[model samples]
Target: MTYTGDVQVGGPADVRELPALTICKLAVGPYDNNAYLLSCSETEESLLIDAAADSDRLLALMAERPAGAIVTTHQHGDHWQALEQVVKVTGAQVLAHPLDAPALPVPVDRTVEHGDTITFGAITLEVIHLRGHTPGSIALLYDGGPAGSHLFTGDSLFPGGVGNTWKDPERFTQLYTDVVERVFDRLPDETWVYPGHGKDTTLGVERPALPQWKTRGW
Candidate 1:
């Protein structure tokens, strides 16, 4: 089967394999939040992104290996509902941005900023801080070379548009600018986007709509 990045709560996770990493995307919690388990193919060491909710299911997915850390994309309550429990069970270090660290359930082991690199075994992910949705919302980047770049966008960038700004023009502008300059201009169009919820999309599919998203002020 192909990895389409289409997953639903209560359904099985979708897996994508790259040359050096394997990404397991599972949707958990009532909000349909997407949590990613990124494992190094060479070492089998893994990192879980978001924890979200449903510790049992997330733990089961990690039963065969040890988790090095859990990265909370932002301070949103829905995004970290299961963080405390999962940390208790796995003892994984919690990573988050400094601005959002105070809101998380567990104390953050490390505060990551833009351009920081998170590593486990042979896998390396670059952190991209995207504001507006939350002061410290972030996206993770994995450059797979020939396989193309992959972005774990959290609530920053999605299929339709950037994350909601609650009708605030200032916030909408900030988010739109960061996404366009830091993400759209920096990365290639083929970059695969795995959002915080729902299915996936690519930069190429969304580039043309940038103007519309800006004009709509969403």
Candidate 2:
């Protein structure tokens, strides 16, 4: 499996034969949230991450790829405002954590949780629950291909800052620890992190910034 886009690929040499996953990041909404499209080369399977806003552009991106599912990182309206439009055009199954399912525009076909994995052809995505940004927030880990390991962090983690803890402070604290431990600590040092907003950064690069983040209580 050859992983394309921002993440690194790890695994056996045979896996290189697997189709590549292409990621297209679209900035939507006033907050400039990132909505992504993950497409597989071999099977032409695609997954949309965070519908956010701007349905027309999202649809146009889907038209260029084989869209199979829509996955929301959290339940915040700004992260899923255009969900209905994207779902209508792609006819893809919508997947989200059970906690955020109720906020989704349509019923979720797959309720993902920690340790749960979704496979589209040769590409397998491991779900990492990163609550705090939202009670049901999740980050996706693509583990196979030449691209190594790539993380779709949604609102949980960002380049210079972490997700806003607007609703629940306790949850945010828990999430901050979870992200630092589960995600930052567990993944390889070279792992690439594609956040819901702002520029992408590697786990290695973000690790050292934790102290600064802690100081700000973010």
Candidate 1 Cα misplacement greater than 4 A, ranges: none
RMSD of 2: 6.1
C-alpha lDDT of residue 111 in model 1 = 98
The candidate maximizing TM-score is 1
**Estimated TM-score for each candidate:** 0.99, 0.87
Model 2, CA-based lDDT = 0.79
**Which residue runs does candidate 2 get wrong by more than 4 Å?**
1-19, 167-169
Compared with the true structure, all predictions reach lDDT values of 0.95, 0.79
Q: Model 2 TM-score?
A: 0.87
Which residue pairs does candidate 1 place in steric collision? none
User: Tens-digit lDDT track for model 1 on 76-186?
Assistant: 999999999999999999999999999999999999999999999988999999999999999999999998999999999999999989999999999999999999999
Give, for candidate 1, the lowest lDDT window spanning 10 residues: 59-68
**Quick one: best lDDT, which candidate?**
1
**Clash pairs (backbone) in predicted model 2:** 1-15, 1-16, 1-18, 3-146, 8-147, 8-148, 8-149, 9-147, 9-148, 10-148
Error of 2 at 91 (Å): 1.4
For residues 136-159, what per-residue lDDT tens digits would candidate 2 score against the true structure? Answer: 999999975565788999988887
Question: After best superposition, candidate 2 residue 9: deviation in angstroms?
Answer: 29
